[model samples]
Target chain A: MPPFDLKDRAAIAGAGASAYGRRLMRSAIDLAADAIAAALDDAGLARERLDGMIVTFGSPIGADADTLAQVLNLKLRAYNQTWAHGRFTASAIQWAALMVAGGMADYVACLASVSFSGLRRPMMGGAGNSEGAREAGGSHGEDPVFGMTSPGAGAALVARRYFERFGATSAQLAAIPVAFRKHAALNSAAIMREPFSAGDHQASRFVCEPLHLLDYCLINDGAACVIVTSAERARDLRKPPVHIAGMQPLPAGREEFIWAYPGFGVAQQSVFDYDAGAPPVYKMAGVGPRDIDALFTYDAFSILAWMALERFGFCKPGEAAGFTQDGRIELGGALPMNVNGGLLSEAHIMGWNHQVEIVRQLRGECGPRQVAGAEVIQWANAYGDSLIYHR
Target chain B: MAANQDDYAKPRPAISALNRPYWDALRRRELVLQRCGECGMRWYPAAPLCPRCWSRRIEWTPASGRGRVNSWVVFHQSYFRGFDAEIPYNVAEVELEEGPRLLTNLIGVGAGEIRAGMEVEVVFDDAAADLTLAKFRPRRGAA
Candidate 1:
């Protein structure tokens, strides 16, 4: 079957996220409901108007679509649950948009919530789910034997190769978290608001060589929701609609742990390959990096944001360290990035907060953190799913 | 030279019926992977059929035991209790000459010395009484 063009058929009517921090003592279900209700309220839609729901999160936390539906009292015509780790939010948005555009549902809510502190489970080990544990130990039987057993370790391997190949420095990579923290200082809901200098970032303890503790994202308890509806319906909603202009899922055949084992060349090639294809997101939306007014790539780790900057063609490969060095990614810079502080400082809702930030920036509602006169925005995840949104 | 099972308590791979051959070969100090009888394509983490051609005609073939370091990392923190004493060990991805990558440790070299594209050869570690792991070390005389 030919791919359907999803450009501008549906729009994000509203977005909302619960207060984010460590150990909020809230169940995943309650957090999801909080965000969902807030989104409905933001859209000025009654609960009965919701026809579909999408729940995305770590499966071990135990809130599935049916349970969330029961908790939110949602009787839906359609629903889906995505388990694609960090890309869950973007994947859910795509599915929600398709459902709305295909007549499967009129109004859909995409929700994601996580309570890392509440679960008290380490990110890796036998104590966690079997799949995560297996992958942590090296899916092919190598990593566990050597004691490299966390996501941070896997990402650090890629960063190390990037440094060796591109001559990028740890001090330069430190600019990422430093800039995001600066933006977080302006955000009232951000978890880590204290500003730190490059020296401070450099002095931070190493979680894995080449990645300081500051490079890791916060483990928090929070949830975020975005409401989607047809463009016509969104026009009549309470807030300005953020159009779903274009989106592209990760190109086929790239594994989730592509960065862990593939050489820098392979990782770099995949990004360039996808861009060369004139991916559906760019082709259907009629936009490119040059047209985007703001950028919001997933920053699960500081290096991820750096990789996105290079992969998305914002700068030449191996130049992101320099591109991000001179406030270029800070608010009011050439390309404001993670203006809502991103996962690093804002919160870790599995990139759901990024979508919230996009809607807020396009609606011109971010107050102090808003990018002036922003219209077009792009959000992407490390796995390569990208969506372009416009006001 | 298998170690007692009690020596290592970390999470072990759940060997399935499909992947039993791969693990059994490791126990015998040899490395083997799935190769499609039809397409001649080889893959790791064993499968029942050729991932490339979907052919049930498959066979287990021994690897060349030589590859280059594709990428690597050193864990500074221990996520599993069994790894606590081994913090800061290196895990590397070695791309074999025959076109499959394996996650293993690079021995006979410091984590600081490992680099991308450095040649490496396979070594076996009997991590537990019933489980033998495939690891790698720098190739002699290769920088």
Candidate 2:
């Protein structure tokens, strides 16, 4: 196989996001259309210019993939349903970039929108806690016989193991939420914009043991979209395009997914294991964890975010708690992460906002939340339940 | 206490051609896996081609019902109503004696005792009408 070179391959020219706060009147399709139109306008591209589109598998009603395609009225040569959940929005952009680079399509639109506003599904109506509610998604074949089911409760088992192995404390974990919320406060689009202290995070109600309510991401109705095209074409367009410098997917493995249940705490046991496929997401972008100008991580759950910091080589394994202490992840730290408020404050539209923020940062369009001289951005797509948390 | 009685109403897993033999073997209280006839690669969720060499020559073989727990989680919350009655059950990823890692459940033991690399033996759950599911329990002295 040839080496993956993304120089002038594809570019993200524009990004748009719907109102992240609660919106009772607009349907999911409307949110998607608004975001799509805004993104196209930002890219200075016509509707007919798009030749490919990608949408999430878990899109809410009215915001489904087909619905967005119909609303956009763009004839698509390629339409891919993403499984990255929210994190996949970035994945979608990556795939679209590949498509554009390989001549499958010239322009593509990637969108993720959900309205947990009026959903009645059990998985949709997560337990009041983030992890607890997520655990309740699929049927437990035999694990249920002993009363094991809630996500939070399930995650607590892993948390217990992590704590036991590393001597990590809940107080240290609480810093993740405190730091994320602190960053979100500067974001006007963020939902939980108020400043929160570790004391406040500790004082919040416990959703699961070691996981306070503050550690969980909130669900809200929102949509975000971005346009991807060849870098040459993008450079000719009106807006600045963030080139796809490096893109790759990490293979699912025991460590990546079921870390809580690894054999000897090592990753090589699983047959599906393949660390070779892991794209050097940080290094390929010509930046290291310390060199990242700003971060737009998918903060679907606080643990997922902290784990990403560890997985992407930002902090040493089991040191994310200390890595995020004292408003470090907020701003003016070694690396400022998730300036858009993330899922906790922004809206849980499946990390699409993370994509929006990356584009905005690349375009230097982020207002007061903007990091100085921010040239590069790093984000991820995460999926799965107890197995894989984030991509 | 039966929180997931409603979740059972959902349809059971559909067996495809690649996996039908494995599921059928389960109905007969046997654990089955696919072995590449040409390359000696053992696998589960039986696929058409050998993952090792990408060869299509493979055969279905009965397993020894012996393996070790690779990793496991005890889920206490029910995602679906069908599993409400059986909350807090253990879903384990096991490395079979024949050399394939399969996702299954651990039976005949409490969830708390489950650990990585613990030796386990297969025990069939045949209560269902169409299929007999394969489960495992910790092997005595196998820890």
Candidate 3:
């Protein structure tokens, strides 16, 4: 029997996005139509050739994969989706790769189309917040009973703990968002590209204390799509195939908190000295943290960036507060991160935007913000899911 | 004085069969957590069995009503209409001595003064006729 590894087994053929804005005034399906069309066009693949789809979020948040297939008039052989969660972006892509690799589908469209504009009420943290309604409480430490609503508040809990445990301050945490915004300034499609300073981050009002308004990701509406197929299929397509070199699925248990790494201890997790110790994704890719040309993450909140850095062993726990500082995570730095402006300034496409950027960056499509000679990039997250890609 | 009792529009716990006993004890002005009779493991938000050992033997026993502030946050935005008046209210995650952490309000202290590891004791807040919530206040001396 031959040894098997998923390394370079699948590849992203093409990527695309719809206009991102606070009030796109378009429906989720409408945004998805553009993204799907654009991705198919980017890959130079006809609409009829697309066979599978995996949507990260559906229904109340965006268009379902089933609906996208119907409305977009796509011929699909397989499709899947998860609930309304931005964290599942990596999960959807991984599944799409598996579907294409296993011959379950030839070309799988992995994407999320979210049009939050013109809603009756805010879906995130106000009275309409549905996260707290879960029976076992929300996954993000959202307990409506104590007014602990919104995903950002849960992140605030983690930020406060990190500050106390690591002697970090809100001023230091500013670097993460600041760097992402700087990257956004280079992109033409980003929504919040004005580029603010740490002082502005400090001056911003605390939506939840210790987490200023800047700390939160924008709630604008938009969509992004990626086309996945086997490495052989991707090579035959238009653009250079960004190979799926490694994959690590999300983790759970008592030690898991959506916002913090284990032992950094937010919820029921026991506090201990967390050691990154070369996690699997790095080993699977046959590369270390140093091999990554640029890094991307689900920056739903600024604190999550630090958590992702520490969780992926980029830096030790309690060290991201410093590791993220002094232009380290910005373009031209040692290890640029979230170079597509991330979810922070790039329309919160539920991390679909980051994936699009990764694909384009690997293809050298990003004009100014592209990492020079970017051959490898990793999408690691605070929630412990990751995917490593290469040109 | 039950301040929250005046207008309890704030979000309340959903008391299901699994967690109703914990809430019932709170309404009785007692703080209790489920202790695994087999493993002696204590926890909050009630489970059918021990999370550690999955023991079917479980009991609701009184907690020490003592804890330390593991973490806390102040809200400048109102997420709930009931909490609108208390715009800058604080939610403190107090780690009870029994080993489970609870999301509760930190009372009798300014949000600015709250700190992780600050000793706290529970205050049974009768928010409404049939509802009581566990809140926390700094422990100045031994109970």
Candidate 4:
């Protein structure tokens, strides 16, 4: 796939997110509705105007995309719930933008939510029926049977591989949570906003090997949505449309299984596979990594954020630890990744808060935690599974 | 005193139209997954259309079961009640010889025994009733 630039094709007119943290009283459906309404309110666009709806897959809730569209009374041309592995949050929005550009719909509402607070039981068992969906297992379905069900375990394998390949240590990986919590200290909305030190992260009890409790993402209930429309229509809206300067997703590629130890012989799934959509976003936006005013990448796990930076060409693969160690990713540095405190401190709303942060940065609205005089912003997500979505 | 043997057991996940092939293939101890005949895309949680090509021409193929060790972790914590006996076990990302990478457990090796780029062969652990879990053992000289 050849890379192309989306100079001024689609724009994000409005974005919204529900309050982060535990909300056991709220059902997942209510949370989705709340988030959808919040986004429409932000865009100053009526709910009736929404013609398209895109949702996420793997959400514990059984509400399908069509069901949500009907309940919201969203009379639209297309409605699809994308595979829900965090990274696609922004990718789903990009898909909505493409649909609108292609005339499939005029206005699209992209929604994602999670009910982590209510998940008292360990995440295991089959992924019951949904749209075109089979239970999430490998070729064998053995892991599910053996109770290896949490995203944490799957991610831990990646983290271990990362360290093994790069010769990094557990202490180095600890720097990711340390940096995020430091930034979270300035974010009032962040769940674990207290300042943390390297010592603090190392001292936290181990949740999985080479991964201490701090290395994991927070399990909280939350939802987020964004409204997208054609750039021309956005001009007449209530708010100054945040132009969708560029959108990029992984290129489609063939897979060859290498299920051995550190399977690097074949690229199972990496940024290399992403369909070359908009040029490296920074270039298409007429900015470079250093010029990025504010940055937001999915923080389902801090390692994801670190890997994204490396893949985006901000730092060399193994050099991310050193760059993070120097406080470059924190506020007042060259770039402030996740200004709204990412999923780690903020609500783990399927990485929707990351999107909220990008809009807030472009609008210059984040208060004490805000980066000063922010102009261009970047938002990216890496799904827990093989699917990679970048926009 | 032990009560009736099966009283407390959780019911098995029912096999339906969507997953019959996957369950049947597993019961036969052959790992099968769908691949796009047009785009050559492989998928788990099999679906009809290729996510990349949008082609409904997907074929189910058995995997080679030989892969390199892409990544791994030694888990010191247990979450699922069924995983209680698996404390300190190794979870691995095996890049199958067939060209797909998956999350599975590695057995027949100690924590220090596993390393990046090591060749591993799939071995079945049929602990659960009617289920054969895919586990891996280190290829000799892989260390």
Quote each prediction's TM-score.
Answer: 0.92, 0.75, 0.97, 0.77
Candidate 2 lDDT, tens digit per residue, B1-143?
24443334422444556578887888888888888888898865467888778888888888899988765655443455555566655667677888666666787878677766689998888645554677788886763
List model 3 lDDT by residue over A66-131, tens digit each.
998887788889999899888898888888877876789999999998888857778897668888
Q: In Å, what is the interface RMSD of model 3?
A: 1.1
Per-residue alpha-carbon lDDT of model 3 for B11-115, expressed as tens digits?
777778888888888878999999999989999667888999999999999999999999989999988888988889998899999989999899999999998
Stretches off by above 4 angstroms in model 3 are A1-3, B1-7
Q: How far is candidate 2 from the true structure (C-alpha RMSD, Å)?
A: 6.4
Instruction: Assign candidate 1 its CAPRI class.
Output: medium
What are the lDDT figures for the candidates, one per model?
Answer: 0.78, 0.64, 0.90, 0.65
lDDT of 1 by residue, A1-391 (tens): 2476678988999899887878888888878888888999999999998999888774556367788777678889999886636656777888888898789998998878887767766554334634444422342133454565566666787787678778888899888999999999999989999999999989998887778999888878898989989999999999989998888876535243434212244321222222323445677689888888889987877888767766566776677789898898899998989998988999988888889989999988999999999989998655567889999
Scored by TM against the true chain B, the candidates give 0.92, 0.86, 0.92, 0.78
* Model 2 alpha-carbon miss at residue A255, Å: 10
Q: Which lDDT tens digits does candidate 4 get at residues A1-391?
A: 3364356678878888776676555666777888888888988899888888888743564245777776767787887886645546766777877888788988887777777555554343323212112354432123544444455655565567668767877787776777677777887777788878888888988776667888888877777877878888888887788877755654322332212111222235541322222235645556566666766776766677766666566666566667777677788877777766677776677767777767766777778877888877777544311111123
Ten contiguous residues minimizing lDDT sum, candidate 4 chain A: A256-265
Error of 3 at A74 (Å): 2.1
| Best model number under DockQ | 3
**Pairs with steric clashes in candidate 3:** none
Q: Summarize candidate 2's per-residue lDDT along A1-391 as a digit string, tens digits.
A: 3466764478877788788766555677778888888888888998887788888744434376666667667788887885424445556766787788788888888888776675555343233222222221222112232233344443444454456556777778777677777777878888778888778878887654445678678867778888888878988887877777655453444233432222323212343312222336644555455556776666655766655665555655567667777777777776787787777777777777777787777777777877778876667432221101110
Docking class of 2: incorrect
Write the residue-wise lDDT of candidate 1 on B115-142 in tens digits.
Answer: 8899999989887888888889889876
Pitting candidate 1 against candidate 4, the one with the higher TM-score is 1
